[model samples]
Target: MNKKGESKLTIVITVFAILIILVLSFLFYYYAVKSMSFSRSETASLSGYADNAGRKESAGLRTNVIIFKPSEVLPQQQKEGYCFSTSVADPFRQDAFRCQVENEIFDPCFTTEEQGIVFCQINPLAPEAFLIKLEKPLPKASLLEFTQDNWAWFVKLEDKTYCSPFTGTRPFFSQDQIAYYGCKSNNIEEQIVLIGDLMIDDIWTANKAVLIKEKDNWAIKFLEQIKIDSVWQ
Candidate 1:
């Protein structure tokens, strides 16, 4: 071959090789990103599916369900000793105690503040009723009372009610508002009774209240918290 022709051939081969390398690199990057994206989507799907399954299973075993989610701000009328009643004729019955200053509603009212809202478990006798004390209490009323039947998601088994407040976390996220409640003839198996937030290992974890049922009665046994690192892993 002539020298000019040979030089031209070499240039063409170099350009083709460079183009092949670029194409291969682009394909590798594209697939790598796609695979990573699929992994993340799969993880999210699994989490959602598992949560849905838990909710469905809980629904099958629940009875006398009364769901309640407290409002951040109370209405003008509710500010004065709000009473939660399911009766359509008398919705706001005035038999409940008012929320006073210094957190003195009753002895040992379990009060906890989460995300600026104060929740007081006023009546141990009535686990279904909780006093939601507003951050900005109205001049007439500082506390708004809520019953299980007042809101949207509590399961009552016999005399006891099982549920938890919303805390923007797993199991208790805004979408999945139903509290996990299940009943078993045998008391040995851990049944998910409530979904709530708990501090575990110095980190806030969305925990489940595992309960044991014996002879038609349910009692809490332990708290189960799950933290998934990676579904693929």
Candidate 2:
């Protein structure tokens, strides 16, 4: 073939190769996002499924026992670096496990001015059903009291009953207006629970995030909503 024809052929080949690369890149990104979203939806649905399966033994009580795993956040004075590592003990099963918190997880929910501490209550039987206290109390007003079904408990937010049937008989305030509860009907293996900010937004929203561990790393659904912002606005 002549030099002109050969050069034209080379140019065509180069363009075709570039197009192939672009198409492959796009597909890879699309599938990765789709897989992450599916995982998050599955986790949220499982949480609901566990709740529905519970059988009530007595009035407002259940035969399925879901114990609260109580965890406390270290004080600001104790923060060593940008990341914090802590261990929690399961009160019922008497087992212990370690959880790590780094900039990727911490920066979303807390601000530089506010002290970021998490008191996590992880269940020994079902580690996924847990509670987190991630706020500093503000000076507001006095505590109020109310009674329902012959059970008396102090109300911190609004005078409303029934946070959850599993979160004890009474629902108490965590920080200011935050109310949290937990219910455990099933145990999930190889799951990572994240509590706090799930997105990088100016609005401070928190959620109870559940992620499944894939291989050595955790597969966080980058596109899907981790957990709804439980922060009461």
Candidate 3:
């Protein structure tokens, strides 16, 4: 009722309001961060990988990428017999990829595009080199064998075409083969929207994430590190 009492009451109310604001701000930030983390997946939608169930195929399987720079190596990159990584979680399984190795993986990146993907293309003869889903265990090759001629998939690594319909999971299938999967909207027959082979569209990642390049620049790169984070049934 007194002046001093009134002043004290106002101060307390002001302090309570400030506290509420601080609390609300913290809550807002916490929720925002949590949502973002959940949204983040350790996957990038690649050309063949897709979010649709019917589109799921061996093309979506996770593969490691390896890149060799021509400036770094003369000629091209060579592949030896192959090495298998033994870190696979299911040690008991006879078919485990635990033993890190290299081989059998024909094209590390999909040569075809999925339903909704965009891509950046490299010269089939891109001086820079790259590999997909590689393990350190791959056999070592001599420098003399490093030319485009020595590439394992050189048979299909030409720039003549960018994408084709996917028939099956033939590791050796070329972009032309991936064409079957597209339609009037996609028919090279329809628009022949042939840009530079540098841009790959309708990209999908192993985790079903779809993505498009922010720019039209093409660069070849191998995966940095491969860690077995989780297993799928």
Q: Estimate, for each residue in 110-224, the C-alpha lDDT of model 2 and write its tens digit.
A: 2223244333222122233222233333222222243122111111111121112122232232233222323221346423222322232322222332344566544433222
Model 3 CA deviation exceeding 4 Å by range? 42-233
Off by over 4 Å in 1: 58-233
Question: Which tens-of-lDDT digit does each residue in 1-233 have in candidate 3?
Answer: 99999999999999999999999999999999987776664243332255554457544543322232223222333323323332112222222222212434222222112211111113334444432333233332222322231112111112222232222332222244221121112332122111112112232121111122224421212112112111111
| Cα lDDT, model 3, residue 141 | 21
Which numbered prediction scores highest in lDDT against the true structure? 1
Please give the ranking of all candidate structures by TM-score, highest first, separated by commas. Answer: 1, 2, 3
Which of 2 and 3 is ahead in TM-score? 2
RMSD of each: 17.6, 26.3, 22.5
Worst-scoring 10-residue span by lDDT in model 3: 111-120
